[model samples]
Every structure is written in C-alpha cells, then in structure tokens.
Target chain A: MKLRVIGAVAILLSVIIASCQSEEQQEFQRYYNGGKIIYEQRCQNCHSAKGEGLSNLIPPLTDATYLKTNKAALACLVKYGIKETIITINGKSYEGAMPATDLAPVDIAKVLTYVTNSFGNKMGIVTSEQIDKDLLKCK
Target chain B: MKKLTGALFIILLYTACKFNAADTPKLPIYGNRDTASKVVNGKTVIDSVYQTIPSFKFVNQYGDSITNKSLNGYVYVADFFFTTCPSICPIMHRNMLKVYDDYKNVSDFKIISHTIDPKHDSVAVLKKYADKLGISGNSWWLLQGKKEETYQLGEKSYLVAVKEDSGTPGGYVHQGWFVLIDKQKRIRGYYDGTDEKQVDKLRADIKTLLAETNTNIAQ
Candidate 1:
C-alpha cells in the first residue's frame, strides 16, 4: 500500500509537469502563428518564404550565429531601416538596405520571436517589453 | 480474368491521359495590332508577322546610349524598378539577379533594368547602385530614361503596368513581371519576378528558347 501511494503521487506530478510544458508550448505557438502572418505580409518579399535570402543581395535569417550575435540590432532593423550598411553572413557580404516596417511593438516582438525560433533556430520568444527596450537603444 | 483486364485497361487509359497532359502547347507569338494578307499561289494567306519591341533610346549604367538596334540578335530579360523603392522592387531585383547569374555565361544574353523614377535614379546613382550590388560589365544594364518613355514602354511594349501612387509604401508602383525577349526582339515569356519558383520556370523556358533558336539555325 505504501508503494502504491508513492506511484500515484509520481504519476500525478508527471501529469502536472507535462500539462505545464504543453501550455507554454501552446503560448509559443500563438506567438509563432501571429508572427508568421505578419512576416508573410511584410518581410517575405525579400527574405523569401523559407528565410533563404537572395544571392549576395539579402542576408538569410536562417543563420543562427548571425541572429544570436545581432539579436539587439534586429529589433531596430525591423522598426527602422538599415541603409548603406554591409552585412556579412557566413563569409559572404550583402549591401542591400532593409526598409523600415510600420509594425507596432507587439507585432515586432512577435515577428522577432517567429524568425528567431524558426528556420533551424530555437532562440526562444521575444516579448514586447524586450522590443521596446531594444528599440530605445537603436542607433 | 475479365475484372483484371478492365483494371489494366483503366490504368493504360489514365497513363495515356497523363502523357497527353504533359505535352505543353507552343507559346503564341503576338503580332502588331494589324492583319495583312498575302497571295501564295492564288491562296489568300493571312500573314500576321510577329510584333517586335519598338525603337527607343535610354542611357545605360556607363552613360552609354542603348537603343533597340544595339540589343538586336540577343535574348534578353527586362523589368522596371527604382532604387529607393520600399515595396516589391527589392524582391523583383533579387529574382532578376538570379536570372542574370543563370545566363551570365551566355554571351548574347542580357538583362535590362529600367528605372521609372528617373529624377532620383540618374546615371551616377544607377552606376553606384550597380556597384553596390556587385554588378559589373554590360551583362546587367541599369537604364534610366525619361519617365514617360519608360512608362510607355512598360505599358505598350512589355504589357506591364506602371504608375505613381502616393498611398503605397513606395511612391511609385509597377508590376513584378520579368519579361523574356527572344533574339528576334519578340516577347517569349513572362514570369513573376517576386516568386522564385516562377523565376525557375523562366530560366527553363529561356533554355528552351535557346535550343529552339539553335535548331532553327541548323535547319
């Protein structure tokens, strides 16, 4: 009877843990789906559907190292365009200007979350607060 | 035995239909908006010769004057874009680069990029823009001409739309079509410049046109 009671408690704990993980996953999914719609409308024209950018013209977002290194600049890039700048990714150079988008802070966060977490990346979610803070520090 | 034979017959018929569907029809050659007749051994043959691009003058990236005659006997792709466009021009420009890379080796193949906003994209600006994009030589010519003439060519010759709109993100608006012109200066195909898959199809069709031209020369 003692062993039976312990097993019941263990099973209950596992169920609770799994439910909590799934809920977090569901929240990420909501952000991802919302971000995808916004990305398709605003970014897909140049970045492409799969984030595989054009040859030497637009830089690819699938590059995990570049995304991680330039995470702060990305928020600014989305809100304010980068002009006359040379972006080097994986030994290749691109010199195209990314025009500024007219998206809100929430939308910018969602888009950042989507791109960072997608295309062979899992960089976690970005909140509106983070985007607001980052935008303030943009050069 | 009869049921097996029926199934086999159905399968054969389905394969036959699939084969037929795979055969693409020859693309139509458009002619000038005029019809003429000729007498071929007393038979009235309607001779509607293929229409060609109208003669026009424009300045290339190197400030060299380029006319329709200069581009004769070459297969070329043409599109219109501006330098500072914040909308679809970037996507179109990227896809055009792909087409350029694919056919850059062919000596007679060229790509023409016309700017509708001539006031901003002058010869110097276009030259600088071309250098920024790492495009050298005459393989890709970024042409800036009179705005009205360029818009006319876009509408009449290329069969694409172009206009200035204030409400759009970019001040100017134009279609995203990459037009394929044959050696004879006739439009052979049109592909969406914003879609990579469609650009791939355009590349394949260019090969088909080149092969067809070779076969004609041999004959």
Candidate 2:
C-alpha cells in the first residue's frame, strides 16, 4: 500500500537522520516522539493539549512539584488509573476516576517522558527498566 | 461631462454595495416539511409547515420541570450526554463551554443537554456534574428523565443518534451533535460537538439566527 511505502521511507529516513546523533540522544528522541503521539491520542481529551486540565474537573499535569515528588508512582497511575480520590494539583483539589489503560511499561515510560518534558517540567527520559521497578512499588 | 458620469457611476457602485450589505446571511431551515392547500379569501392557498421539536417533559439540574414550551421563545442548542461518559463527552462539553461563555448573558439564548442514562445520572448527579464543570444559571440546563423518552427525543426530534451499548467505554453510545433550534423550534443546523472548528461554526450560525429574529421583531 501507499501508506506502507511512506511509512517505510519515514522509518528509513529517521534511522539515517538519527545516525548522526549519539545513542542517548537517539533513545530520547525515539521515546519523546512516540510519547507525543500517545499523549495526544489518550490524555489530550481530558488534560487538554496544553495539559491545563478541565476547570475544577480534571487535574492539570503542569504541576512540576507534584510530578517530581510522585515520579515513581506516575507509571502506576497511568497503568492502573486513579480511583475516587481527591488530589491537589496546582493548589486545586480534583476528584474523579481516570480509566486505566492496557499500555505496556515501555508505553508508560514514553508517555511519562513526553508529559514531564513538554508541560513545563523537564525530568529527562523515563526508561522501561525504571518503569518496571516503579510498577513493583505501586501501592 | 465624463467626470460627472464617473461620479454617478461611483455613487451607483456605493449603493449596490450598501444594498448587498443590508441583506444579512440566513441559516437554512432543516427537517421534513409538508404543504397543505386551503381556501383563503375565495382563493386556494398552499401553506408549508416545517417539522419542529415536539413536546417533552424533563427535569433540569435544578429539579425544575423543563418542557419544550419552556424553551418556546428562546433559541436553544440540544445535545445528549451522561455525566460519567469516558470517551467523547468530556471534549464535547469542553468545546461547548466556549459557546456557553459566549451566550450565557443573552436571555433569548439557552443550551439544554438531555441525559440518556437517567437511572444513574439523577437530578443530584447532574447538579454535581454541572457544578464541577462551572455551569450555573438558567442559560444551560442538564435535563434528566425517563430513559426511553430521552433517547426518543434525541434520535427522533434532534436527529442525533442515542442508544445503550454495554460494550462501549461509557456503557452507552451517542453522537456528539449540538443541534441548533430556532425560535420557531425548527432545527437550523447540527455541529459536531467534539470538534472545535464545528463548534465555532455553530456559534457563528447562532448569531445569524439571532440577527434574523431580532430584525423580524424590530420590523
């Protein structure tokens, strides 16, 4: 199909383009790009494109302090979803249930990296290995 | 002599533009219509009647009874949604808030959202949801009533689809259409509630309808 050919060319072009960059930079680029698509598809509806969240309903993801403090638990929150609990974000308490996703650990890391990095909070790339460790500690 | 004719031509062009500007764009009336021939003043006359939003009764978020008669004079937008909808309802309302903010102060404009899942989304639940979504006043009313009546009104009158589906995320399926009804209770347009662009178009069309009615009353 035409779509398959275009996709193949895009992948090949990316590989050639990424050859110039270091391994670490390439890894981050891959995760960041992949995470952007995932975030737009899954989280953009509620959190909004800018992660500003719905007013008094869904909590914003722009709280850098909250993301930093709960860095380890982010994976669990994305994977298992949030229950009926009020959490304070940016000085506002939001109560609602977030539907759990069936995404794998790597997806969790990719999306987390995208969320943290783009939304005025830069915490670097969260790897699948780190996500595996965090999932074990989910409570 | 040529200069005088040029000045006259300029005046003619100005009048032409003015005439065109005076004629405002109008929204097309949507829905089925029928014509009946009758004798008036000993002459046979044909009159066309457009389909309108039929009579229905439901309770708003404030527990006040809302009938089609309640919205008789006001131009209103109608849509079907539930509180705990996980898929499209959030985005639909988010986009709708833009329209709400634009016309909240306008007395003749209103928005009514009927709930398809009346059993779970009771009067109290709709109230809470409205509160959380920053909705207040009579401008926007979230109505809840018998499930069958609500679904029938949405599908039959508003021309939007509504059904109960357990396999879906929210356990119900419905189109995210913001149906615009004129002061005469006829549908003017339908906009995809989930898309910001379409919602923007809906607001523009609302202004057109309002202007059309305002001029009619002024004349």
Candidate 3:
C-alpha cells in the first residue's frame, strides 16, 4: 500500500516537472522560429545563412565568446546599426558600417535570441524585457 | 486532314532536330552582330561581325593602369559596384567571391570590378577594400576611373544599366550583372551576380568556354 502511494506521488511529480520544462521549451521554440525569419530577412545577406561571414569584409556570428561578452550591446547594435566602428573579432579587426534596421524591441530580442542560440552558441532566450533594460544602458 | 498531319509531323521533326542541336552546351554570344560580305579567292565569302568590347583605360587597386589590352589574352569577368553599396553590392560580391576562388589559380582568368562611385572609391579606398576582402595578387582587380567613363562603359559596352539617384539607398542604381568576356573580347554571357544559382551557372559556363578551344563549335 505504501509503495503504491509513493508510485502515484512520483508519477505526479514527474508529470509536473515535464510540463514545467515544456513551457520553457515552448517559449524558446517560439523565439527561435520568429527570430529565424527575421534573420533570413535582414541579417542573412551579410552574416550569411550559416553565420559564416563573407571573408574579412564582414564578421562571422559564429564567435560565441564575442557574442557572450558583447551580449548587452548587441540589441543596440541591431536596432541603431553600427557605424564605421572598427571591431575586433576572431583576432582580426573589421572596420565597416552596418546599416540600421527598424526592428522593434521585442523583435530585436527575438532576433538576438535566435543569433545567440544558433551559430554554435547556447545562450538561452534573450527576453524582450532584458532587451529593453539593455537598450537603456547602450553607450 | 492528311496534309495537316504531314505538316504537323514535319514541325515535330524540326523541333526535335532543334532540341538535339541544343544538347551540346555552348554559351550564347550577346549583343548585336552584323554580316560582312567579301570575295576571297574569287569566291563570295560572308562573315559575321560580332560586337566586341572596346578598349578603355582604368586604374586598378594596385595603382596600376589597366586597359583592355592587358586582358586581351585572358578570359575575364567584369562587374560594377562601389565600396559602400548598402543594398546589393555585398551580396553580389559575396556570390562573386566563389568565382574568384574557383579561377584565381588560373593565369588566363581575371575578374575586374569597376567602381561606379569613383569619387569615394579611390585607389587607396579600393586597395583597403581589397585588402579587407582578403583578396590578393592580380587574379582580381578593383578598378576605379572617371565616374562618367565607368558609367558609359557599363551601360554601352557591357549593356548594364547604371545611374546615380538620390532616392536609392546607396545614392546610385545599378544592375548586379557579371559580364563574361571571351579572349577575343566578345561578350559571351551575362549572369545575375546576386543569385547563387546564376553564379554557379556562370562558373560552369566559364569551364565550358575554357574547354572551347575550337572556333567551329561556338558557331
């Protein structure tokens, strides 16, 4: 009788945990899918579809360390566009101007979430709330 | 009804013959052509005069003057773009880099890119751009010249539309065409440089042209 009661409680706990995980997974899937469309529309040309950039003329997004370190600044960079600033990535200095996009804050969050998660990166969802908070601190 | 059947049979046979003729792949010669008739050894000889690219002088990224004569013995592809085009130039060049990598080792192949915005894309700027693009040696040349000269050469010789407009994103309008020129300076083919499939076809066609040593096959 005690084993039966324990089994019932264990099954219920497992069900609750699975449901909880799926909720987070569902949010990730939503952001990733939405961000993929935005990436293809806007970023694919320069950063490339596989994120292998076009030679030294453009910087590759496959560098996870760069993305991780510059996580806070990425939202601003995507929204306002980077000017003729020389940025060093993969030990090489690249000086080029990236045109600005009119993507909204939430869309920026989605796209950032997409880029950071894809391209050999495992950074979790960059939420819209976090993007809004980061935008306020962009230099 | 019998006559109609015979005519339809003949038409089908003719179309089949045309399809067979097209099986051997050959790049089409573009632009207008005229026939020249002359008497050779007391026989009436008719020859087709193909439109060829005229000679022009321009400076390359190395600050070297490159003219049409330098490219006489080599098969070359020509394109027009500025260093700072925000829209299609990057994509065009990105596609073109495949062509560059494929044929960079061949001594008889060359790629020439003319800067339509010569005012900003000077020799130094072009050189810097080339260096940044990680392109070296004479396999590819970033040519810059008088803006009007480049535009005229682009529009008239290559048959590509190019103009300046303030409304455009880059302040200039141009087609993303990679014009393939044969050793004889005739326009052999034109590929849309922005599309990967077209660029792939361009690469394949370049191989076809290189293997096409005999003049009779092209006819």
DockQ each: 0.29, 0.56, 0.51
Instruction: Please provide, for model 1 over B1-219, each residue's C-alpha lDDT reduced to its tens digit, 9 standing for 90 to 100.
Output: 999999999999999988875543244455355668999999999975667799999999899999998898788889999987767877887777777888888887899999999999999989978876778888899998999999999999988999899878778778888998888888888889888799999888888878766666677
Candidate 1 has a DockQ of: 0.29
Badly placed stretches (over 4 Å) of model 3 are A1-21, B1-25, B214-219
Model 3 CAPRI rating: medium
Tell me the deviation in Å of residue A125 in model 1.
Answer: 1.3
Question: B116-179 in candidate 2: lDDT tens per residue?
Answer: 9999899998998999899999999999999889988888888888999999988998999999
lDDT of 1: 0.85
Q: What's the candidate order when arranged by decreasing DockQ?
A: 2, 3, 1
CAPRI tier of model 2: medium
How well is each residue in B112-164 modelled by candidate 3, as lDDT tens digits?
Answer: 99999999999999999998888999999999988889999999899999999
**Model 2: per-residue Cα lDDT over A1-139, one tens digit each:** 9999999999999998868688898899899999999999999988888998777888889999999999999999999999988998778888889999999999999999999998798999999999999999988
Candidate number that wins on DockQ, 1 or 2: 2
How many collisions between residues are there in candidate 3? 0
